[model samples]
Target chain A: MRRSRTALFVLVLALAVAACGGTASLKGAVRNPPLEVGTLSLPGPDGREVTMKAEPGGLLLVYFGYTSCPDVCPTTMADISEALTELHPDQAEKVTVAMVTVDPERDTLERLDDYLGHFFSRRLPLRTEDFDRLSAVTAAFGVQWEIEEHEPGDQAYDVAHTALTYVVDDTGTVRVEWPFGFSSEDMAADLAALLEEPRA
Target chain B: MKRTSCRRRLAIASVLVVTLAACGGGSGGLEVTEAWARTSPAMAEAGAAYMQITNGGGADDALVGVSVDPAVARSAEIHETVMAEADDEATHGSDMGGGMMEMRAVDRLEIPAGETVSLEPGGYHIMLLDLASPLEEGSTVELTLTFENAGELVVTAEVRATGP
Candidate 1:
């Protein structure tokens, strides 16, 4: 009887270890920065108001730029799109991309949808809304933007804004921000790590 | 012999006048100010760039073409944005000019002197073709501008992020 009891204890110890290992939390860091997001009502291409709200619900990856931007916006957006493409189907499903146009004058709902669509071939939808809400999102996330005045009457007039990407988790707290100009591999690794972390 | 010498001097004076006008030196007012350009990131095969070419000189100047590192770009073309001919003002036409915007390469641009001919966003711009890599911010791209009169103007363009 003593030998049997000892064997039973050993079995329980092994089972316990296995259970703890399955629940090991990933070491993903969330931003401790304060956030400031306000509601905005920008018109979509369909002529509908694409209202944006500060939802701490699902994961949010936010960036601020115009569709007319030539270099950095496309690069950043392309990198994100490629990283999303590389993720396993399950991992890809959980992530969401949100773009805000500082130049709402041009990056209308229609334009944002169209611009992001080019970069994102996947059916995974990207959310875009008005400048105010977008500005609020950036402000809350500590993103910076300045209106760049070019020659008058030039529609190509663009805004010089920050090339930063923010990651917000299910709990709606800004978890991390990746600056502009990240290689596809680095972005993929960072995103994968975030996905593996335990739910907050 | 004295009369012959006078004729020779007159011919020389005519040549000097022609040279001065053609070269645009000291009088033609080849003014270039606020000139800028941009390149895409990740070494795009083709990218659009912009600049402001302000000629304070009281005459007109033309930007014929631009030359950067030949190894980096095959050729840099001057481009202007025009409404996509097929574009309709209404409907959910998601497809417009494919791959960014359609940049019609411009062979020449007339910058009226005494006016700031700004080639900024939404205006005339220099398109940098096929980059070796993305134009990293703080990295300056060497550009050589050839004018109709000013010959070649060598300038360094600071590569910065669109919104940084």
Candidate 2:
């Protein structure tokens, strides 16, 4: 299975390169059987419980990280922000970004809001201490997170988590998944194509 | 003499452009270049700074400590983002480079003689904790870096929205 996936990835990479930024070619990894993530009721901005759903004819981006992360999380957010700017105004407006905090103990809803507001104006800060709900969501998205045990008063405990971003299309299906270190230009191009091109 | 002077001038210019830092002092100790920090939002409690530290001296050096100006942040520590080894079964067949990643404080970053060590995103970095104020774009923050051999050297890291 690993070998086959690797082969497919290489083939896709070759095709992407050959196409040379052609329309309908996505830079991210395309989910063969697109993941269906229907509406989820979670705590959203302004302390409101909102139904998390992709807008019709739009896209939804979901990420998992903590605000205290000084390195990777902020970098990814900045890249996403940059990518959105690269998109056409119409396409950009149709996108929604939602972030789930893996370190709920340290990441208050207010902190998440503040951190996400820096990059994008339209942001959803999802945080819940309920392990069952969080686990269900993360497991469905194939995200894993582990918080190191530390003293109760210690605020320096670190969290280990998956660094993948999922892109949900208008149909509430995860069409593509971007890995860590995905460039903003490529992301922007993929997003544009996802919005403009008809799915094969 | 004219040829030697011209060659020296060319070398200096190259150093300026490539290193983005002043030429090494008489001893050619260490040069910190391309130092910058990403701008933080108003309520951001933490930030990070990145740079390339080149040891031009014959002796090796180590970046042992870091501290931000109190006005910029309450404290600073050298950190490294490491990909935690995940259960093979969990990450298997995932093409998204999906894995567990973590960050931890790094005690020392060694720079061998004539070697450049980079403190960059997704790698070694200077983690700023309890940011006193938002690192505004187009602004600069002063950082005091202490090395095993170079003692303490101050560098102004320009605030940017992204990596340099």
What DockQ does each listed candidate score?
0.05, 0.28
Instruction: Please tell me which predicted candidate would have the highest DockQ against the true structure.
Output: 2
- lDDT for residue B162 in candidate 2, whole number 0-100: 89
Give the fraction of true interface contacts kept by model 1.
0.04
Instruction: Return the clash pairs for model 2, or none.
Output: none
Off by over 4 Å in 1: A1-30, A33-58, A122-134, A150-153, B1-46, B49-164
In candidate 1, how many Å is residue B28 off?
30
Q: Using lDDT as the measure, which candidate wins?
A: 2
Model 1 score (lDDT): 0.56
**Cα-based TM-score, every candidate:** 0.47, 0.82
| Candidate 1 TM-score for chain A | 0.69
- A85-180: candidate 1 lDDT, tens digit per residue: 788877777777777667665554555665666555422223344445554555555555544456666554545566667666555545556665
**Best prediction by TM-score:** 2
